[model samples]
Target chain A: MKKSILITGGARSGKSALAERLALSRSGRAVYIATAEARDDEMRDRIAQHRARRGAGWTDHEAPLDLVGTLDATDGDAPRLVDCLTLWLTNLMLSGADWRAAGTALAEALPRQTAPVVLVTNEVGSGIVPDNRLAREFRDAAGWLNQTIATACDEVYLSVAGCPLKVKPDDVSL
Target chain B: MKKSILITGGARSGKSALAERLALSRSGRAVYIATAEARDDEMRDRIAQHRARRGAGWTDHEAPLDLVGTLDATDGDAPRLVDCLTLWLTNLMLSGADWRAAGTALAEALPRQTAPVVLVTNEVGSGIVPDNRLAREFRDAAGWLNQTIATACDEVYLSVAGCPLKVKPDDVSL
Candidate 1:
């Protein structure tokens, strides 16, 4: 049976770094699933920086949409790290994709995968209520998506100031 | 020595409720400190809703800018629950208050207070980098404030979907 880890934190909270560390800890071919699209210069630069930081040992897969499909296409034996669910949510929302359906599909597919998977997501619901409708909707959807993914994962961790705090496996000593 | 508790979470993540619950659990008078200023109808409604939810058994104190002064004026024996630090930060920013200086003052005052303090603060750093400079600045300031308060508090909790996960006292069993 494969293990699924959900790592959630704020921007620059070291969530992706933690996920990468976890993925590297596993013994197998590691694949980095990039959910962000370089839609603008800053985003493009961010993508470049992430790529440069990862350096040399992993296979990269881009899945701005059809995340479930991309995961399905990857070799089952390879350990996979999905860089983020937040960006994927944004992609879905911007592209007019059915977020609910996409979320459901991803949830269903996660358990069926043969490889150990580490997912990184942002915990965006802890901020002030956004004044704009789009931001508010995004926050709600992200929160719901996070809760759904967390429920499906074997272990869940919330990162703060680069520290990973185990939230799942609730019985485990903190 | 009086205890200080920091409750941090996303918007609608139940940080305030958790803070209130903790304050009520304590054996003493409870004072509610609200930092939000109703500049618009929607904000007014929100303030009204929060006020309605927290009815009776509590004295309400409004401190949009003078948080430290207001806190000082309150009865020192009463356990005070500050509804949030995010709004207070907003108030400070809008009023051109020096956030760094204000934060330092807060840090200094919290320890000297005789009353137990339960603070609610939003974790705004967990989301995507905001597009505008002001929003980005706000996120950074909020993050810094949270970290500062968390360090000072005897207990710090990160709430997610209404679940309170203890972050401070790093070694104790949860």
Candidate 2:
């Protein structure tokens, strides 16, 4: 069976970079599933930077809100790397999409894929509680999303300071 | 030799709870050094909740600032759990204290302690980049602080969804 790996860490903790590296390590074609939308200049710049970093050799798919559908459509032979889930959550919240339904769809769709999948998610629960309601809601939703996705994954890694620590399978040799 | 353990996680990922549990697991007195200040009703209620949760067998020390002095004065035989370093960072930022210097002081003081210490900290770098400079600065400072403290500590665990993942001593069995 193809394996699903989840990589989580704080901002700029080299999570996405690690995910990219993992995707490249696998055989066959690589697919990059980008969940970020270029809503502003900063975001646009960040997306551009990511594109530059990934270089050539990977297919890019922008599915800010249609993650399940995109994953369903990808070729089974190609390994898929979902760069992040937090921004997808933000997009869902902003678009007024039902989080539970989207999360359910993601959970149900993941196992159906034939290709190996590597997911990158932000571990946002270790910080101070946000002062605003929206931020708090996002934090809670993100936490739920991470837990749900992590449960479905065959391997989970918590990235810190550019190091990847295998979290799941609890006894796996790193 | 006394051991210093650093526990890091996102907002409500059970980092503090795990630290508290660790403190309770050890023999001797448990000292909880709280860094939060009850500046508002919300904060006061949160503090009250923590107090109620800890309940009875622990010594509480409120040190929004002067963490070094408080640690210096604590009984050497008791286990000390600083149920977070992030808020202390906020307090320092608000009070115009030098974060680098304070972090250096903490790094220096932790090794000299006689009692086993468990420090809870937020892994704030994994989220979306804050839109403002101050928040960005805080994120960078917090990351640096975690790295510095983790370097000095004997053990490091990254908490997530109430589960503790041992990160340091890479070969130790979890």
Candidate 3:
């Protein structure tokens, strides 16, 4: 039962809610891994909203950078939900860490987990090309990251307007 | 039979390629309704690249604004492929036109089409929210448009790395 699922969508596309549902579906209790840091008021508000929605039946862990370590340590009977990989990448990028290597390591680490790991990410490359070079570079990296992680996962889905559309392990080829 | 399809994804996610395949899947020759206007060298180059990839059997039509009318005009023997809806929306917004009204009109016009129509659009809302107000507004409009068009379409797909995953007319809820 290696239920390694990657859920990706736009901002406010209901990815976290869906991930929460899947994480708690099999087991009433699950582990919540927060990759986001509340550095500002906006970030704090978002984090609070997510926390409020997730309510109970969840043990939370803050793993902004050391996601692999968090996953390895949390390996047990309870399923783990990484609310996002994008923020983890952002943290790595901002800290001058090798994000490519980090992303690869996470993909490599997915298969060995004893507990179900439901990861979430954002789709940032589909819009018009950004005017700034950094935004362009970030979007490019995000797209590549999504493709790499998707290749390693057991299942992948793209959420739209709060609806999940399974993409990987699907019959249709792109 | 009416076969209106909406194809959406991020940049270089293989949206246009998938739209072309679907457009020609039923008819050997299909009308290419491009909403893009070659106002500059970059845009011209991109348009040329698309044209080169499409190769033969495509009758090109430029309707940067009047897409609903273009669809009606091209409803004859060949199926029509609107290379994008996002660009059309951009044109409308830039011109200070009521894009919401136009988007709704396009959706309403889809059901009355006698010929098959394959509309391509971008998924712009999946990324980090833009820092600028205009980009934010555009992404919001694009997301609303995608959902609206999808509601009217017989099929809706999200392209990923050159693969097509059907989202509409499927049993998978959400």
List iRMS for all predictions: 4.6, 4.8, 3.7
Per-residue lDDT tens digits for candidate 1, residues B6-100, read: 98878766667668777777663489999998899867977897778776778888998888898889846778989889989989998899988
How many clashing pairs does model 3 include? Answer: 8
| Clash count per candidate | 8, 11, 8
The residue-by-residue lDDT of candidate 2 on A1-174, one tens digit each, is 237888988788999989988888866459999999899999999999999988877999999999999998995787899978999998898899998789878977888888888999987765445658777768878887887787788888888899997777565121
Candidate 2 structure quality by residue, lDDT tens digits, B1-174: 237999998876767777888887766359999999989886787689788878777988988989889998994788899978999999999999998899999999988888888899988776566778778888899999999999999988877654578778677575
User: In model 2 chain B, where is the ten-residue run with the lowest total lDDT?
Assistant: B158-167
Expressed as tens digits, the lDDT of each residue in A6-84 for candidate 1 is: 8987788888888888887766348999999888999999999888877766899999998898888984777899988
How well does candidate 2 score on lDDT at residue A1? 27
True contacts kept of each: 0.31, 0.28, 0.36
Stretches of candidate 2 exceeding 4 Å from the true structure: A1-122, A125-131, A144-165, A169-174, B171-174
Task: Please give the interface root mean square deviation for model 2, in Å.
Answer: 4.8
User: B154-173 in candidate 3: lDDT tens per residue?
Assistant: 98887774457877778866
Residue A165, candidate 1: Cα error in Å is 2.3
